[model samples]
Target: MGACDRNCGLLSGAIIGAVLAILGGALIPIGDFLINKTIRKEAAIENGTIAYENWVVPGSPVFRQFFFYHVQNPSEVMNGSRPNLKQIGPYTYRMRYLPKENITQHSDYTVSYFLPNIARFEPDMSVGSENDTFTCINLAVVAAPAMYKSGLVQIFINTLIKSSNSLMLQNRTVKEILWGYVDPFLKKIPFPMERTIGAFYPYNGTTDGLYRVFNGIDDISKTALISSYKNKSTLSLWDGYCDIVNGTDGASFPPFVKKNHVLQFFSSDICRSIFGVFKEERIVKDIPVYRFVVPPAAFASPLVNPDNICFCTEKVLSRNCTSAGALDISACKEGKPVYVTLPHFLFASKDITENIEGLYPDMNEHETFLDVEPTTGFTIHFAKKLQVNLLVTPSSRIETLSKIRQPYLFPVLWLNETAIIGEDKAEMFRSKVSTPIKMLHLLEAVLIIVGAVMFLGFMVSYFICRSKKLK
Candidate 1:
C-alpha cells in the first residue's frame, strides 16, 4: 500500500505537470494567432504605410491638419466657444474663440479650439489633372490662411497627435471621417474635448450625390478611372496589412471588401479604368469623354419596386425609365426574388483580421457577398439594379424634425460635442457612420475562447491530483 501510494502520487504529479505544460504551450500559439490575426484585419498603418497615386509625394500635403476647438464644458451654451474666425491664405484659416459662461449660471465651459478640418490646410497640393480641382469647404472659419498652408497642415497634424490624449487621433486620415470609418475603441473615449470629424472628398466630383453616381455605374468600364484605381489600391493595401495584423495566412485581398454588393464594381473594368487613365495621362492629355450608363436592373429595390425589374426614379439623371412603364420586365426569374448585389467595405483600425478569419472560416473565400437579410448583417440596403444608387430617405425627415426642437437633435449625446446641428442634414449624415461598439463584442468572444481553453486544462490537472490524493 505504501509503495502504491508513492507511485500514484508520482504519477499524478507527472500528469498534472504535463497538463499544465500543455496548456501553456497551447496558449502561446492561440494568443499569438488571435492577436496577430486581429491586428492585420483592423490596423491599416501596421503592414506598411500605403499611399494613393498622389500619396505623400513632394509638394503635396505631407499631413493634413485641422484645429479642434475642444469645449471644456459642452453643456453650457455660451461659454468656451471659439470666435473671431479669420482667413490667412488659400487653403489656410485661423479661428479664435473665448470661453464664457451663461448669465445667471455658475456653470463653466472649457473651450479647446483647433482646426477641425486638416485637408484644407494644404494649398500647394496639386489639383486634379482635368477640370477636377480639389477644394475644401466648411473647414474652420473657411477664410483662415492656416487652412491652405501645406507646411501648417503637416505641423497641425503632428501637434494634434502629439498633444491630444485621444487614441482615435493616432494615424487617422481625413478619409476616415469622410469614409465613415472608426476604430473599435473610439466609442469608449469621453466627449466634448475629444476629436470631432469632417468629410474628405476623394472623387473628382462634389461630395454630395457622389455615392448615387458611383452606384449608377453598372459596369466597371463606366466608372471614372480615378475611382477604380482608388478601389484597387485600397484593396491591395488593406489585404497586405491585414495579413500581419490578423496573424493569419497572407494574400487575403478584398478581405472586408464585400464584393457581393454592387458597390465594389466587381468587374475588371474598375481596375482597367483606374490604371488605364493614368497611363493615358502620361503620354497624352484629354481622355475620351464617356457618358454614364445605367444597367437595366439599376432601379430595382425591395422597397421601391419588388417586381425584380429595374425602374428609374426621380433621382436618376441618365434615363427616365419610370415613364416607359418598364417595371413588368421579367429580368427576375420565377420563384426568385429580384435582388441586386451591393459592396460594403469593412475597415477597423485594429485586430479585425482575426475576428474575420474565424468568422469566415475560410481564407480562400475572398469575395464576401450577401443577400439582404437581417441575419446577413448588412446594415445598409441595396437596390435591385446594381447600377442605380438608390437613396433612401427616412420617412420622419430629420431636417424637418430638427426645425421644431433643435435641442433634441442628438438623443445619444456620444462624445458630447453637440451631436446634431440645427435642422441641417449633415449632422444626421455624420451620425450614421459605423461605430466600434460591435468590434468590441467580437474581441470579447476571442478572449472568451482563449480563457475557456486555459480553464479546461487547469481543471483537468486539478482532477488528476485530487484522484491521487484520495487513493
Candidate 2:
C-alpha cells in the first residue's frame, strides 16, 4: 500500500484502541484511602507518643493506622479554618466518623475536643541509677469534611493535608489556635435548654437517638448567641449557662462527660454512645422543656412573580444590655420558666415549604403549614411557572416566652403546608427527554444509506475506468 493508505490504516487502529481504553477505564472501581502508621511509642522526656483506637471502617486494614494518625495529627476541617492541634499525649485516643451527608450546612460542623488514648514510657537518666517515669501523652482526633453536599473525599484529604502542614509549622497551644477561629469553627449551637432544635435531621426516626434536646428551637439565627454572650453580665448569671431544675432530686451527667467544661453537641452516633453511658450511670435530670413560638407564616409566603422565596433579617442592639441585637423572645411559650436562651434569628419563609426540606429533611410535617383567611398571613407560592394547590391547619396552642419564673420555653410547632400542583401525570414514570435512542437510530440509518451509496459509486467508478481502458 502507498504512504497515504498506510497512514489511514494506522490512524483507524489507534482510534479503536483509544475507544477501548476509555470503556475499560469507566468500568473499574477503587477502594477508600489507607492510613499507615510509621512510629508509635512513649515520648522520650518531652517527646510525645500517640495511642489511638481504630477509627475507620471496622474491618479495614488501615483502621489501626487511622487510629494512630487520628490522635496524633491535626486536620483542617472547615471552609476557611486551619488544621491546628495540640500535642499532649500519653492517653488513649478514640475516634468517630461523620458521613459526608450528615452535615449539609456551615452551621452543622463545630469544634470538638476530647481526651484520647494514652502513651507511656520510662525515662533513662544515668545508666543504672534509676529509670524513672518520663513524659506521658494523651491525644484526641477531630476530622471534618470541608464540603458536606459534594466534593467529600477531596475535602477530607485537603483537611488532612492542611492539618499536617499546620502541625509541622505551628507551635501554638491547641486552645489558642482553636479559639482564634472560634466564630467560624463552631457550628451555630442552639439554645442549650431545649430538648431539640429544628436543625437536627431524622428527628423522629432511629437516627434521632443520636440527638437530645435540652432546649430545641426551629430556624434560629446566629446573631442571637453572640449578642447574648456579650451582654452576659447585664443578663442573669445563668444567661450563658442553661438552667435545668432537676425534678429527680439532683442533676448529673455520665461520668465521662466533664461537668465543669462547656460542651457543644450534635446529632451523631457518638451522642447515642454518651447517652448510653448516662443511662448506665443512672443520671436522669428532669428539667422543664418549653417550646419557642414560631414566627408568622407570612414571612415564608412565596413570591409568585419572581419564582423565588425571600428572607427578612434585622439587627437591633439590646436595649437594657450591652449585647447586640437579641432574638425577639416575646413569641416564646408561657407558663414555663426560661432555663436557657441561645441566640437565634426568627426566619419567615417566602415559600410554603421554605425549600429547606431538600437539605434538611428533618422538617416537622405538621409545623410546616399555610396561613390563610382566619390565620391572615402571607401566601406561599411554588415555582413561578407552576401554580400549586396547598393544604394548611391552624394550631390552637398559644406560645408564650416566660411565665414569670420560667427559664426556657420549647414549643413544638408541627404545623405544615404542602403544595398540590395538580393530579399526577400519566407519563410520570416515562423516561426523561434526554434519552438518546432516537438520535442513535437516526444517525445509524443515515450512515447505512451513505455507506451504500459510497460503495455503489466506488463499484460504478471501477467499471467505468475498466471500460475506458478497454476502449
Candidate 3:
C-alpha cells in the first residue's frame, strides 16, 4: 500500500478513536450525576407530583392479621398456675388509608395533613370468621381497680362487677374483642369512663393526629421526615428523648439510602418512633431491595441498651424496670397496664415467655422488617409484628381480683400488618426507576470498554505506520 494512503488511514483511525474516548469519558459521570439529581427532584413532596399522589393515597394493599390467644385453663391461671394458652384464628382485615385532609403548605418547606385509617374484615384471607368465640380475659374487669385510685371508687367498681356477675375470663366474639363492645358494668358506672372497650376500638375510621412533614424543597435528605405530630414536636407520654418524635411516616423516605444507615419511622399505633437496621439485600419481583430489620436490642433492657432507659417510666422502674424485649406502653395507652413485644415473645426475657405455655418464638415468622428500594427510598415490602400483653396482678382491694396468684403478663393478641408493592406499581417502578438506572450503568460500562479498545487499536496502527515510513 502507498505511504500516503497508509498515513491517512492511521490519522483517520486516531481522530475517530480520540473523539469516542473523549465522549465516553465525559458522559459517564455527567450522566450519572444528572440522573441522580433528577430522581431527587422527582422524589420531593410537592403538589401534583407522583410522590405527592402516592403519599396522599398509597397504591399497595395493606393486610392486618390478628392472632388472639385463648386461655384453655382460665381457672388454673387465677390460682397461680401457668396459663395454658392456645393461639386462635388469624382474623385478617384489609386496611386502607383515606385521602389526606386539611393539607397545608408551610413557608419552611413543610406540609401538614391528616390521614385516617379504615379497616374491613376479609373472610377469604382469615382462618375463621370474626363471629368465632374465644375464652378471653375481660379487660374491664381486670383493669378497673388499677384505673381508679380512690378507695370508695374501687369499692363501688368491685360492687358493680359482682352485681353484674362479671368474671375474670369471659367468652367473647373476635369482633367484640377487637372492635368494641358495650360493657354492662361500664355502662352502669357514673364516672367519666369509656363504656366501650376493645383492643383496637379507637383506631377504626380515625386519624392518629395532624402530621407535618418535610417536602424536600430546602434539603433533599430530609424529605418526607416528620417535622411534628398533632401540632407538637414531642409526646407527653414518654420521658426524655423517647418523647421526641423523630422519623418519617413509613410511607416514603429520603432518596439514596446507605447500607449502614438506620431507617426510622413513627407508628401512631405504637405511639412512638421505631428504627430498623440493615439486615441484608433481597430481591423481590425482579427488584432489588435492602432488608432492614428491627434489631433485637431495640426493645432490650436498659442494661443491654442504655438508650432505652428513657422508655421506662416511674412505675416500671419501681418494679426494677421492664425485662428485656418488653416495652411498657401504659403511658401511651391511657394509663392501662399494657405492654408490647414481638410476636411469640421472639426476643423477650426468658421469665416472660416461660410463664406462658403455648408461645414458640420463631424469628422467621415473628420478626419485624422492612424491605426498601434503596435508590428511591420506597418500602416495597414490610411486615410490622407486635403482640399486646396485659399486666395482670392480683388486687386484694377488689373481690374478683382477690385470687391466689402472682403477676402475669397475659398474652391478649398479636397483629401482623404487612404490605407489598402491587404488580402494576412494581412494573411502573421498574420501567421508570430501575430500568433507567440499570441502562445508565450498562451504557457507562460499554462506552468505557469500547472506547478503550478503539483507542488502543489507533495507537498500534499509528506506531506501525510511522515505523514503516521511517524504514
Candidate 4:
C-alpha cells in the first residue's frame, strides 16, 4: 500500500507538470503572435493624422551652370554651342514638409510645404550684367509657342528690352525669370509663404494625383511628390507611394522577408518615376533600415512619362528624347525653357551625354537610394539627386538670339537633398523600438527552452520513482 500511494503521487505530479510545461511551451508561439500584432498596429500611422519631414541640401553640392550658346553651323544664325566653361550649384538648400494632411479615412492626402523664402538667387557669379550676355555667356529667354496662343505676344514683345538690334534680357536672375521680379506689374512673394507641393489627388497613388502646380502659368510644369498612398491605403505614409511593383506598404511586410524586394516611389520634380530593389536589411544608427539601391531597370516605370509628368513636354522643340526616354520639361518655361534631367542622365543613352557638353555623368554618385525603417516605413536617411538644365535652342525671330548653330541641353545645376534622423531622435528610437524588440526575441527563446527542460525533468523523476516501487 505504501508503494501504491507513492507511485500514484508520482503519476499525479508528472501529469500536472507535463500539462503545465506544454501550456508554457505553447505560450512561446502565442506570445510571438501577440507581439507581431501589437507591432503592426503600433507601427501603422493612424488615419486622419499628419506627419512632418525635414531635409537639407549642403551648399558644397549645389551645382549650377550656364553653357555658352555658339554657332555650330556658321550658315545658320542660331545653330550650335558648348556651355560656358563653368559649373554652378552646391548652394545650401533647406527644405521642410508640412504635416501631410490625411483628408479621407483612406489614402488621400495633401502634401504642402512651409516655404520660408527660399533663396532663389543670392548673387552668384552665374548671374551676369546685361552687358555680359554680349561678351560672356548668359541664359537667353525664348518665348514658348504658347505665348502666341495665349495672346501674350504683345506682352512678350513689350517685355523685351531693345539691345543692339537684339532683344536683350533686363539683367535678371534665373529666380527673377522663373518666379518673377519685384515689379509694379509682377506679383512677388513678399516673404515666407505657403506653397502646395501637390497631393495624392487620385485614389490610386501609383499613377495619379502626384503633381502640384509648379508654375501657375503652365499646366505641364508641375512639381511632383515622389511617393503617395495606394488604394485602401493605410494612414502610414509609406504604403501609398513606396512599392514600385504592387501598392502594398513595406512596413506592413511580414516579420521575415526571405529575399530583397522591389521598392518603388514617385518623384514629381522633373516628372519621372523611380523603382529599385531592396538589397539588404541592416541597422542605421541602431534603427533597422531596408536599403534599396537604384537598379538600371528602375527608370522604365511608365509613370515617368510625358502623360504623367510632362503636361506638354512632348511638343518641346526637338527637346524630347528621340529614343522616347526622358520627359523633357524645358518647355515648362513658357517664356524661356529650362529642361530638367535625371541626375547624370541615368536612363539616357551614352549619346545623350556625349552630344551635350558640361554634363559630367557619374552613376556612382547620382544613383537614387532610400533607407526606410522596416517596421515604420518612414524615410530616415536618403540622398535624392537631380540635375537641372536650360534648353538652348536658337529662335530667329527673337532679336536677343545670339547666333547659335546646334541646339544643346545646357547643364545648369545639380543638387543633393539628404535627410537623416537627428542624434536625439535616434537615441529615443533605440530605447523605445530597438531595445524592446530585442527583449521580446530573447524572451521568446527563453520560454521554449525553459518549458522543454521542465517537462524532461518531471518525466525523469516519475520514471525513477516507478522503478523503485517495482523493486
Lowest summed lDDT across 10 adjacent residues in model 3 is found at: 313-322
How large is the C-alpha RMSD of every model relative to the true structure? 27.3, 27.7, 2.7, 11.2
Best by TM-score: 3
Q: How high is the lDDT of residue 235 in model 1? A: 31
Candidate 3 per-residue lDDT, tens place, 1-471, comes to 787877788778767777777777788889879877887777888976657766777758889999999999988876667888899868999887467878889999999998877889999999889899999888888777558767888888888888888877888999999998998878878779679998888778787679999998789899999999999999888878888898898878898999999988998777889999999999988888999999998888888898989887735313777578888787778877888889888898876787789898999999999988898888889999999888777767678677736666788999999999899988988888888888877877777777777778877987887897799
Candidate 4 stretches greater than 4 Å from native: 1-32, 47-79, 97-140, 143-161, 164-261, 298-325, 330-338, 399-402, 442-471
Query: Which of 2 and 3 is ahead in lDDT?
Result: 3
lDDT winner, 1 or 2? 1
What TM-score, to 2 decimals, does candidate 2 have? 0.16
| Residue-wise C-alpha lDDT for candidate 1, range 1-471, written one tens digit per residue | 574565566556555555555565565566556633543333221112221111112111123222211122222212212111111111221111111112111112111111122222234532211122222222221111122235444334434333433221122333342323343322333444222333322322222111111110122222111222221333332123221111100001112222232322322111110100001111001111111122322223323444322232222211332322112111211211111221110111112111111111121221222221111111121111111011111111221111221110000000100011122222221232122223443445555555555555555655665687789
Give every collision pair in model 3: none
Winner on lDDT between 1 and 3 is: 3
For 1-471, candidate 2 gives per-residue lDDT tens digits of 764555455455445544444433332221001111111011000112111111111111100000001111222212112212222221211111222112111232211122122211112311111121211111111111111214554344335434443211122222222112222212222334222211111122122111111110111111001111111212221121221211100011111122222212111211100011010111001111111122222222223211112111111212222221112221121211111111111232222223112111222311222211010000111100100110111111111101112111111111111221111211210111112222433444555455455545554555555566569
Q: State the lDDT at 456 in candidate 2.
A: 55
Score each candidate by Cα lDDT.
0.23, 0.20, 0.84, 0.43
Candidate 1, 290: how far from true, in Å? 36
> Ten consecutive residues with minimal summed lDDT in candidate 1?
409-418
TM, every model:
0.19, 0.16, 0.91, 0.56
Candidate 4 clashes: the total is 37
Worst 10 residues of 2 by lDDT: 60-69
Please rank every candidate by lDDT, starting with the best: 3, 4, 1, 2
The per-residue C-alpha lDDT of model 4 at residue 407 equals 56
Pick by TM-score: 1 or 2, better one: 1
